[model samples]
Target: MTTIMSSALGFASNRRRRAILALLVVEALSLAVISALHLSGVIHGGTRPYNPEAAGIAEAVIGVVLIAGAVAVLSSPKHGRAAAQAATGFAIAGFIVGLTFTIIGGQPVDVAYHAIVLPLLILTLVLSLPKPRDLGVGRDQGPVSKSQ
Candidate 1:
């Protein structure tokens, strides 16, 4: 029974890990497209004059970081968790700043994009957090057992 429960938990963890990776990939692709659109002046919104090139470049960098995080997650869950956390945190901060400017600059499309993606990023960030076991929770302080 314990073995069966362990297997089930492992399967669920794997599924959740895959889902997080998929979200990261989708987000990176979205960022790439958004950056390209802005760079091409196709995403111009509102009357405020701002530098689309700068915003596009910033977003492209974030996308690259996200891709790296995804690759890391695929290779090693332990290290990848940190990478994903950093990437998502960075993205959240960037989006918040971007959203602030977008709202103040009166860029409705950009504002909408931030609105849609920001929450998803936050969710991904939360989901990628380490489990209690990973943080030494409920861990034995005595001599380690072979099974452990």
Candidate 2:
């Protein structure tokens, strides 16, 4: 019974991790699009409502982080876990900074978007952190047996 429950939980965790990876990929693409739009001057609003410079920086940084995070989550037994953790930390920090900026001088729409997107991004980062054994590789115990 306990083994069955453990297996179920393991399966759920892997599913959640994969979902998080998918979310990160989507976010990376979204950021890339936003960055491209900003660069092309196609999605312009105004200085207070939409600062292209700041938006470009945010988009580029978030896109890079999300892509790196997805790659880390997909790979295993390497610097992937550490990279995911770093991406989580970066997302948290970016959320705080964005919130602060919103409170200071951002418009309502911009502030609302930041408030919503930042938390969701943080959630994805949190969900991406999986344990080593959950990856279903092996333990660092004794050598493998040659049994039938």
Candidate 3:
């Protein structure tokens, strides 16, 4: 579609797009740090009161998913929006689940940070993404949406 193509090509009109890109970078870095913490046993926010091993595994999985999503975005600028959305999903799940775990066994501040802050950031970025229809050549306007 023209919208996606134009965004892919220039994306000059919306300055927020750059903010989105920056957030995506932050997400990638956060995930990597989380992965390192879990795998290397350097998790933050006080001592582990619950099952650290399980938490570590979960964190690693989330890290991998986010990294894969980032790769998808970087690999194809024209289709990066979808990739970013997918990454957001992983971020949402990780934050919620991690929040729950922290609330049950860790500090209240950790709970607040995970439950309130992280998800809001992720959702903000997700909502900021341009819809596929905005791409100008959406499936609805293509051969698939046409009746035979």
Give all candidates' CA lDDT scores: 0.77, 0.64, 0.59
User: Which 10 consecutive residues of model 3 have the lowest summed lDDT?
Assistant: 1-10
Task: Give the deviation of candidate 3 from the true structure as CA RMSD.
Answer: 5.6
Pick by TM-score: which candidate is best? 1
> For model 1, where is the 10-residue window of minimal lDDT?
2-11
| Least accurate 10 contiguous residues by lDDT in model 2 | 1-10
Sorting all predicted structures by TM-score, with the top scorer first, yields 1, 2, 3
> Candidate 2 residues 71-130, lDDT tens each?
876874244445666776786676577557656665565566667677777777666555
| Candidate 2, residue 14: how far the Cα is off, in Å | 2.5
In the range 15-97, model 1's lDDT, one tens digit per residue, is 66788899899999999999999989887755554556767888899899889889977887556667778899999998887
Task: Kindly provide the TM-score of model 2 when superposed on the true structure, using C-alpha atoms.
Answer: 0.63
What candidate 1 gets wrong by more than 4 Å, as runs, is: 1-12, 45-50, 133-136, 139-148
Error of 1 at 64 (Å): 0.7
Whole-model lDDT, candidate 3? 0.59
Q: Cα deviation of 63 in candidate 2 (Å)? A: 0.9
